[model samples]
Target: MTVANRFLSIDLEKCQGCLSCMMACSLAHEGESNLSRSRIQVFQNPFGRVPDDLKIHYCMQCEEPACMEACPAGVIYADTEKGNVKRIHTEECIGCMACITACPYSAMIWDLENQHPLKCDLCADTPYWNQDRPACVEICPMKAIEVRSEE
Candidate 1:
């Protein structure tokens, strides 16, 4: 498959845990009412503790994805036809946490009630039909996040 250069890049140095990205992301995924169903998970070292600090986590949609390999259900697949967008087939997913464990970045979050893995899809349709970026990139008050060509 041909890899596309499109990606949503986060500049950690510029992020201050404002969580506008999370709010935006959740809203984008789950609509305005439900933030808990959002895909991305933000981590902090607890009270802004040292070493770990704060970071917003989400799928990088890697070229050689470990999460894709780890899933036994084959729920994960690449939209190689659509700019190499990696996506999870919601119907195929069995709520197993295999992909969640496989992710090195700890980007996966388990939806306890729905029993599904949650991660970023990077707003593929919005930017396709309209000239808008992902919601997280749009809502980030710090402007620390960016969506750009990886190349």
Candidate 2:
């Protein structure tokens, strides 16, 4: 699987799992500080090594998005205007979870409240954080996550 260079990259060694990135993501996109609403996540693995102990989940902005291909309702589309960010048309989604299941990086998250899948859109239309990059990148305390050079 040769994916194009992703919009976001991570350095595991720098992450401490404080979850500031997740909080910022949720606040920016969902307007609340709820971990469940966050598009990016940090999972702690007790059995892993120092850096490998933390796992970050975020949209890669794939050139060929698996989520888009797996959508039965054809609601997931790429926003060419915003660096081809993969987004879901919530109104048209069928809540089938195919996109969530097909995502290679597990980037598509289930919106428990909306009954739909959610993927990172780089805060293209967010009202909370009026920044050039995604909120997560800016809020990362350890600077573990960063916008990829190609973007």
Candidate 3:
């Protein structure tokens, strides 16, 4: 069956860099508020002249994902039912760090403790807190992030 592909769309202009999304993401995935483990990250543009130069970074879930191709262990695969969302099977991951190097956007985050790389999976296609949305999108106070579905 064909399923609509979902992607997280960010409005940079609306982002306040409060990092509420990152905190929420860590809480949901790690059962604690640890930004280091968050799949989503916020970076401040150091060379920018303006103080509001911040960027929210996360997986794009590309049509052709480099991470999936770079995984020698075949841990990363696309979820066809969830609109081809790219996901990493942690159990099968070999922690080769290939996905981290292959990502052009540097969206993949390394887990120092687990020795595995992490990326956004749109909350693993599960309902968060009874809501059918990602924790980051739901907790954003500025509403800077949104999930868009492509048919």
Candidate 4:
């Protein structure tokens, strides 16, 4: 099994918790600027810690994805071109919520409108916005997010 050369990386220290990445991701994938549809989420501490309390949450793109195994419909798959990034085949998904339960990090998000689960795919080469990178990384002003490639 070959490891992915390119992967998403985050620097929590630099995150401002503005959620620009979430907005960019939602716009790129869903054609709308809705945070509910975003794959990435920013969690802030209730105590109001400025930079330290912010945490960016998203798929880990596990080497052995539990979501893939737990899916009864076999909609979740690994993207070979992008280093086995776990992705969901939305059309094939049955909205069983198995993937949501299987995700250890609670990264799998439920889409109420689409009746399907959503996870980070590194913005895989889709016709909607076929770029070699993710929208979140591109739109992040603070440069807290990055696409790290093993060269």
Candidate 5:
């Protein structure tokens, strides 16, 4: 299968435990400022610092995606037309949470309101689709997030 040439990269050292990335993601995608609607999440440690202080739940967009393999309805697919991004066809979804559980990175976000799973499509089909980069990358004040490509 064709993995995306462009994918996300994160520099945890530059992260300041800010929720900007999350807010931007939610707003751009769902037209809301809800953190739960955000595809990216910033998890901070209660008893640690720096590296341990953050566990970002942003999709790594793996070369061998477990979520794609686990989808029974075949709703999650690598969209070749959309930069080979792994995307979910919400209309075809069977409301199974297998993809969510299969993601080792915990990046497969479950949309509570929609009763479906949500993953980053590299901003290929978001409300802010015209931008050069994803909302998280563009709105990141610390530049903690970025998009990298094989090319």
Candidate 6:
């Protein structure tokens, strides 16, 4: 089968509120502990009844990402090789809040101490391909996620 650049998409229909994705996301991104540092967040709808309320939230990595355009520091860049991967050049960032504010999905967050933005790179810098999928996709006990090319 031919492969295309893509990300692991979580099926909200199957998520059980286990938060394994959040844990994995934090571990991979921060290289340390702290839930606030995690790029992916799970929220339960206060108004929804029972199971439908729970869902995992993260970047959709939109076809045209606002975060990339909003960064005044020019830290965010689309991966020329993979297209699907977006990267932030940490060294170039000036800790400006433009990108975080531009993200409609709230996928971006401020890294206070570092004074930089912290968000999901979808584990792109890691050795995820040789393994199964990203750590979040692999560790999801409910098997609620899958990686695929755009249709």
TM-score of every candidate relative to the true structure = 0.83, 0.88, 0.90, 0.89, 0.91, 0.83
- Measured by TM-score, the strongest candidate is 5
Report RMSD for candidate 1. 2.8
Error of 1 at 21 (Å): 0.9
Clash pairs detected, candidate 5: none
List, residue by residue over 113-151, the lDDT tens digit for candidate 5.
998998887787775555358898889999888888663
- Of 3 and 4, the candidate ahead on TM-score is 3
Assess each prediction's global lDDT (C-alpha) against the native.
Answer: 0.73, 0.80, 0.84, 0.82, 0.83, 0.73
Candidate 1 local lDDT, 6-83, one digit each (tens): 556787777777667777776676666355666666666776653349767777878788999999999998876556
Q: Which model is ahead, 4 or 5, in terms of TM-score?
A: 5
TM-score of the candidate numbered 2?
0.88
Instruction: Point out where model 3 deviates above 4 Å.
Output: 46-52, 125-132
Candidate 5 residue 14 Cα shift, in angstroms, is 0.6
The TM-score, computed over Cα atoms with residue i paired to residue i, of candidate 1 is 0.83
Candidate 3 lDDT tens digits, 24-78: 9988888889999999999887777333688667999887889889889999988
1-151 in candidate 4: lDDT tens per residue?
A: 6665556788987888888999988888888899989999888997878687887779888777899999999988877776677888899898889999999978889999989999888887543334355898888898888776553
**What lDDT is obtained when candidate 4 is compared to the true structure?**
0.82
Instruction: For residue 72, give model 5's deviation from the true position in Å.
Output: 0.7
> Could you arrange the candidates by lDDT from highest to lowest?
3, 5, 4, 2, 6, 1
